[model samples]
Target: MQDEDFLRRPAAPQPYSLTPAILYLSSDAVHATHKLLQRAGRNESCVFWYGERHGDNASVHSIRAPVQRSRRGNYHVEPESMSEMVRDLRAAWRPLAQIHSHPGVEVEHSRYDDAMVSSRRILSIVFPYYGRPIANWPSDIGVHEWQLNYWHMLSSADAMARVRLREFADVEVRDFR
Candidate 1:
């Protein structure tokens, strides 16, 4: 929705603005993420996006696959593993989103997913079919953000706008699995 429309709403204005947050990702980063997740086969997998955020826009330059336990249904990343994954990363790079894979088409957040996410401030994206390409990346995929008391899943259109995929070089992928 436009800024004017958002302001015209009847309810009390939210503490946060409705201005959409944009995540800039390169095609290389997207491919690396899929490869990392697809390695888990029928199990769930996760890769964290770390990058530079300026205002409401961020550019994902690194994809880290932390050492985590994975199963057919879920995955878990330990605190120590997370610490190790980013030990050498630059201080300025921030966690942009947590991307994971689901075995099936269902990409909604489970209760476990809600609790396991490293940060509510970042986006939680779930890729379907064990990270295989599913009806174009980021569209059918689950892209949720923390809103109010829950993780609100954005619509396909919103998801596409929120994550802009571009052709670029120099997307680094770190696999600590």
Candidate 2:
């Protein structure tokens, strides 16, 4: 094989087919995620949404916060930490999204975030104001998905169609603080 062919990037991501097209989240899930991120104050923190998927629809049934090192602008979760956090979760559960906090309203994923995301097959949602979340649900929040070769932030209209926050839904919360 030519050097160019050998050096070429891996095949384009498989379109994340295993992920649901529309994910329904419970208000409690949002509340729990915000609460965990807020505890870090000015530092950025992260959590994960894990659940089951049925066809194009999925419901978030669990929230998990890995033991991560948070800074004002970035956070890091060791692979081992992530594994330990999810080890006890239901065997059938799959991670739907990784929810993180930013210091400002710039919800766009940073270069660091793009590289640090746990999985290309899952969504990545970023909240502003260190997760205090001044704006309404989904508003000002950055919902990102991996497509082609990049992480694309969904527009408001797209976000609405993709993720819905219900007033009430059952969600189990686990934090590795």
Candidate 3:
């Protein structure tokens, strides 16, 4: 029920690194996506820490903008926003990996979603929230299970960084964990 619980829970420890300025997701990282989705609805952005090596230093990456409520009744990150995101990532010299929500259901990429994801030379993270209660959750920590799925891209180290810079403009870094 709290972020502390997540921190203390016995789950696979995904390797990560935190900068005084940003958090990083190392390769082999995994965690719950459900909580993230819920937070996104509140217009809060989240990032992932990815490292190239299995348990090496990871970087914090965030998602910008809101997930559009689709006309077909699904949530989606708008293409225009995605384009801007890619541009921003290129500017930052990071790869594209977006964190989005699935409120209370299974989060999986649709065919359309895949098509969009495939167009980029980055990673895609589909976080699905299963409607767990976190009212008593800590502001700094959270826990959930994330299934591993990815697209292969030749990189210097088999990893990429997807950062959400918009968060820095709105909230303090402490609010992100």
Candidate 4:
């Protein structure tokens, strides 16, 4: 399979809904971090993150980093800023993954994103298409999956792809075989 196949998944025909409980019930710090990453994305209408990863057993809470942008409504983060974030993460004994959002933007991973993630785990959260009815984590060149409207995670490594969605409640898992 091609690299694109590694990031692609079948899309559902409808939108899924995520309940608050589902978002609050994660036992994995990584999973909780992902949820907090989502809120930080929506909170700033831009992007936010912990600047570092967390300890395996630490609770994913009270971690946030605000991104700076120009007055022209353009977002920008410098190399110095990233270095500082990593420094802070090191101080807090956290992981090296950075989470941020692409609010009101459909652009895929850009050169800048590549540059940032090149040295760390970069998680990009693209917000609502505003009114666009596209699938969650939808992309013509990437992965797309359904979670009964809760969460979607797409990954591609070594031409191997995995797409999985976690539901907000108990739901049937369809077997297409």
Superposed by TM-score, candidate 2 places the C-alpha of residue 165 at a distance from the truth, in angstroms, of 1.6
Q: Give the better candidate number (2 or 4) by lDDT.
A: 2
User: Which residue pairs overlap in candidate 2's backbone?
Assistant: none
Q: Is candidate 1 or candidate 3 better by TM-score?
A: 1
Candidate 1 lDDT, tens digit per residue, 1-177?
A: 111112221322243234468999997888888899999988888999999999989999889999998888778888999999999888889999999988778777776676778898899999998998766777779887877767666777788888889777767889998
Candidate 4 lDDT score at position 123: 32
Q: lDDT rank, highest first?
A: 1, 2, 3, 4
**Candidate with the greatest TM-score versus the true structure:** 1
lDDT of 3 by residue, 16-82 (tens): 3322222344222222333444544533233432222223322443333333433212444555654
Give the top-scoring candidate (lDDT).
1
Of candidate 2, the 10-residue stretch with the lowest lDDT total is 1-10
Pairs clashing in candidate 1?
none
Report, for all candidates in order, the number of backbone clashes.
Answer: 0, 0, 24, 7
lDDT of 2 by residue, 117-146 (tens): 889988899999899956566868988889
Model 4, residue 45: distance off in Å is 7.2
lDDT over C-alpha atoms for residue 57 of model 4: 22
User: Which should have the higher lDDT, number 2 or number 3?
Assistant: 2
Question: Candidates' lDDT values, in order?
Answer: 0.82, 0.81, 0.33, 0.33
Kindly give the stretch of ten consecutive residues in candidate 1 with the minimal lDDT sum.
1-10
Better of 1 and 3 by lDDT: 1
Sorted on TM-score, best first, the list reads 1, 2, 3, 4
